[model samples]
Target: MTDTPSDPLKTTPLHARHLAHGARMVPFGGWDMPVEYSGITDEHMAVRTRVGLFDVSHMGQLELAGPDALAAVQHVSSNDASRLKVGQIHYSALMSPEGTFVDDLLVYRMADEHFLLVVNAGNIPADFDYIRSQVAGFADVDLVDSSARYALVALQGPAAARVLQPLTGADLSGLKYYWFTHGEVAGIRGMISRTGYTGEDGFEIFVPPADADRLWLALLEAGAGEGIVPAGLGARDTLRLEAGMRLHGNDIDRGTTPVEADLSWIVGWHKDAFLGREVVLRQREEGTARRLVGFEMVDRGIARHGYPVLVDAAPVGIVTSGTQTPYLKKAIGMAYVPTGAAEPGQTISIDVRGRPLRATVVPLPFYKRSRS
Candidate 1:
């Protein structure tokens, strides 16, 4: 998930804490971050069975306010923001007029005239600038990059709420998925959202930078009895991959449209005017030439990003994300392929270092938590 270190990297509020704990630091999206602590497999299992904590302070947050916020948001995002009630959040994308993702983001409706957009770490500047330029047409909308106000962390896994319930006065049990509440976490006032990249049930807490260390420590201590472990970017990637979550630069990019990415559900087809609506409409009706789908190796090989995909001995598409999942214990991946070859039970070939390996197209979310 990290690019080779070249430019000086930015540090999060909890960078020192990570170093103190012997986390393997790497440069990811211009930020110095922990790739792993104890180990990726151990951390991944901790989240699958018990609980895991993650320092996600590098994520960017944008706050939109003013009377025309809903209208402005609708114009820039793919989702129908007007449907989001107060305290609710929805997954959407900031897109160009051509339907390619500028960034996939979560839109939070905090109030009638205020909202929040949580974007990926790497695309902050571009995402913010694009949103600003698109929404500038609205008569009354104010956009502010508010990433400086919060140091974010996620308490994810089966024991997430159990671990976090004691720290906050807010009723964790009452907060449904994709909803958030304002409360004090370990005595530090912040916003807590019941959303996460990991497929497991979790909570992402946003607190001011100054109080991050204390909050982090308090959580670790509180969840110690529940076998909570500190996870890093490595585990995060594998977990999200298993959960069928997209990593920006990998799974989807400027060349891929939401329709081709199989995220057309986020498009508000009923909306009068929104960025990229026409292109999305045309794709949905006319059908995209290619679509993103999940697959698993039928042979002894692991798929990685940018690996070539072959359909009937001909190169079709390429792998977007893949890994030998810690929990599932199998090599699984996602890729864009011809629509005819994207369905489950379809067999395909992966060019694993020039050796063609057989693979089977499978339904997405290679892993899902048992609800019972």
Candidate 2:
């Protein structure tokens, strides 16, 4: 659940389409988004077994271009932007000087001197300000916030390719994962990417806002026979949780560093000093006091965020993310605990509603799809 902002709720381009599908609207990142349609469980299952469409237009899109675009991106982001080839996408983190997450984002290399950054909805203003500050030192880079101009729709599931292939001339099979190509999808020119947060084979199509509803309706009509359905934030959260994909505000935040969050892999230690690299290097050399771990409930109760985690009956940390996953059918959660106690198979107790429930540390990504 997102905190209600002081500003009035913003609606996505597909707001009317969501309502027409009988969606349950809720506040998310200051936007009135669909939490569920049909039902969370049903939508979750659809994405896992078949296909599901999601209106993720609330995500922010920032465009960077000019001779110094590469230098500008490499400065604000932890990952090496120089490593990304054109038409490729890389997951990266933007951090504060103190080494805490500003937001996790996707860096899309559209051209040698052009890039598109997709950042979390809630952090749009902050992220934009942060990036602008970094780019100010460079003379040649030009930045543009094109978030409102585009609508992002994620078509995710095992059958996603089959459902989407016929509508676009782009060779869906030829497009490798983590790559995108500009093409006409459903007769609308857009950037189609083989990326998704649901841990399924899928595509994230970025289309003009005016063409959003038309492309949405077209995809639905074409995919109806393939069991495609519209999914909402509720199912999205559960799906990502099951995939062990961290949610920005929950699993990671400004209070947590990449090292403590077990995401040091995203930091390009070899690259020239990016923001937060010094602190990250120190953490790497000294090691973190606490580490994030995945766990499953050994007891009956469902673990929720902020619930205290106990080690030998003493509070060690609190749960960051937890839920009863529809596809996994298990109570799973992620938490930050002392590094010494972060090993798999370590028995811990979670304080759920003042009662301690037993749980065990387990490997992340409670569920993995069969590649074959």
After superposition, candidate 2 runs with Cα above 4 Å error: 1-6
List the lowest-lDDT window of 10 residues for candidate 2. 1-10
| Candidate 2 per-residue lDDT over residues 31-135, each given as its tens digit | 999999999999999999999999999999999999999999998888888999999999988888889888999999999999999999988887888899877
* Global lDDT scores for all candidate models: 0.92, 0.93
For residues 181-262, write the lDDT of model 1, one tens digit per residue.
9999889999999999999999999999999999999999999999998999999999999999888889988778888988
Model 2 TM-score relative to the real fold: 0.98
Residue 151 CA error for candidate 2 (Å)?
A: 0.5
Which residue pairs show backbone clashes in model 2?
A: none
Per-model TM-score versus the true fold: 0.98, 0.98
The alpha-carbon deviation from the true structure for residue 35 of candidate 1, after best TM-score superposition, in angstroms, is 0.4
Model 1 lDDT, full chain set: 0.92
